[model samples]
Target: MIKITEKSECCGCNACVQRCPKQCISMKEDEQGFLYPFVDTTSCIDCGLCEKVCPILNPFDTKEPLQVLAAKNKNEDQRLKSSSGGTFILLAEHIIKQGGVVFGARFDTNWEVEHCYAETIEELEPLMRSKYVQSKIGNTYKEAEQFLKDGRLVMFVGTSCQIAGLKRFLRKEYDNLLAVDFICHGVPSPGIWRKYLEEIKSSRSEAAGKNTVLSLSLKSVPVITGINFREKQQGGYGWKKYGFVVQAKSPSKGDKNSVLLSSIFNENIFMKGFLANLYLRPSCYKCKAKNGSANSDITIADFWGIQKSHPEFDDDKGVSVVFIHTCKGKGIIKELSSRLDLIDSNLKEATLPNPVYFRSCQEPKKYSLFWNIYKKTKSVHEAVNAATKLTFIDVIKIFLRRFYNKLRRTFKMVN
Candidate 1:
């Protein structure tokens, strides 16, 4: 049986739970809203399968990428809808066209992120974009294994830890399996996410001159129809400084779309807390799968410093920095070359702008303080504000930084 002595030891990948032949291991959410495996000692056979399949205990060796390149989907509309360069959609479509399945993180009806599989191109929409919250990987490892066993092509896209988990669970390699991981910047608490949505609904109701008290009731509250964590269509900023958008149907408007909340990523309250490293999963602070340790076929991430590195490629649209690790990854990229505008790039430039590619984020000093406040008030806003409130000097520094960045961009454009 496996035991989680420290929270950081578990990545909530659900591999141990699925690997347990006795089915004694269960994933339970902790106070921080991250899942950790719990073993039922009575039912556990002590076969040690759980420990055998743990990615953290037995991580893969880091390997140098075969090819590093910057790529963009040729389809302009698809590129705009995606959080990055829409490379994921291309990969998923490729697998689906080959009569395969694609597993990825997507939102449930209540907006809680979960790992699910899509079999067709139409089913791939929900799997697109970025869900910053840690997704519930409910038996996805087992599901993917089944598809692979059936000799069907299976593509699994998730954080590095998740890809590691799936590979560990399978115990062997599969020619039909394509594991794609991303440059992850920690996953935030789902509990905080739920609270944030409720707060947004309450605030919107009060603004609409409706009774805020009624918002407490699920039936009376407006239904959230859509949520885009990385809405790239901000007026001037576009993909460079994407917005966070939430759309809902108002009950008073007879289920019509009435509430649309939009804010730049930096301005959004939830995003502010997330980016500040307030309430990310414990494992995120000490990720063992960073820097190609997950042994994924391919890794994709936003080309954050594309403007500085490849000025001509910076169209204010999205660009993806792709690291092809295995020959399988190279083959797929070659197949999809016609559909993407590919540019040869080096790993140094990619990692320079995105340090999360190799290193885990430092745990914020106010991490404990934020949880303490949340425990008392149960308010995501109050906890985040209290924990991350900037001093007068901090505000001035931030303003100066933004001004400097703006001026530099302007100079680059003129040159």
Candidate 2:
């Protein structure tokens, strides 16, 4: 009879909700619509299975670090369309083509990040673009597992946290289930992401002569181009850098939806205040998914190293860094080889920049100081201006620092 009071410690892992044989424990949404788990005291059997399976009270240790083909900025159509690399979509397409279900994020009616099932390539198209928010997972894994049990292939793509949570929930490995998790920065809360989009659309409306399509991308801006990824090498774990411009192209222009969401909410999304809009549960900040071993079949990120190494690559064209985690992952890459225009080269030699913004551990707090300054004001327009005014000098200074450190490291290894 584990009474879950407010005083009792809970990690919000949802294990108790799943393990309860009575199905008493369920997710309860607060006024803000943030889902939190609660127990139905009347149905309590006191079996303690909930206590045993709780990842919050008893977190699992990362098995071991395994990495391969660290790439950043892989140039390809799918990579360009993806948030980082084109791998997720490629993997999803293959699974869906085989009559499997692909699960990922898509914008809901309110433009909030919500998980959806993609049964066709057209369904996957909308999901291809990165939502940059912690997408609502509405029994997606539970439903996918049922499909997997039906002897159908199911491919699920999301942040490391989502993948970890799904694997934790499923417990047993199913051959039909293919799990692909992003090598990601933390996801922004859906509420914050929605707010950011609202502000972005409002501003973009002001920018465009009239309002029309809700679209945004980082492609036009050169300063804010590089995507991040994990790069484990022969010597040790390090960063692999790649640069690509994410062009924010809207299908149509609208009075209310022209501004870039990332540009507007860039401050909060990067991290600030008591509850940074971008964080998942508090534990995600100290994620066990940090060094891989996240139970993901394939781990992928933006191939950041490509732009410099493969100078011929068009920045807007897109690039992705793919990591093959298991046999399935290797198979995915092998399959993609035909579809993707790839060049086999060690990322460090090919495109590893001097310093990476997100992957490298040497520098702390990857975001610009604008995040703190924007927190001083609540106006989303002001935040957009601040982001717009972010001088090239400031970005260059940070990039230069990272560059010099990388140069030093490269020299040491080369000598």
Task: Name the top lDDT candidate.
Answer: 1
Quote each prediction's TM-score: 0.92, 0.66
Root-mean-square deviation of candidate 2: 8.9
Candidate 2's error at 382, in angstroms?
6.7
lDDT of 2 at 279: 29
33-109 per-residue lDDT for model 2 (tens digits): 24567778888878887777554444455543233453322345455455554667777888888999999878675
Worst 10 residues of 1 by lDDT: 205-214
Worst 10 residues of 2 by lDDT: 222-231
Q: Model 1, range 339-405, lDDT digits (tens) per residue?
A: 9999999999988989998989999988899999999988887888888898898899999999999
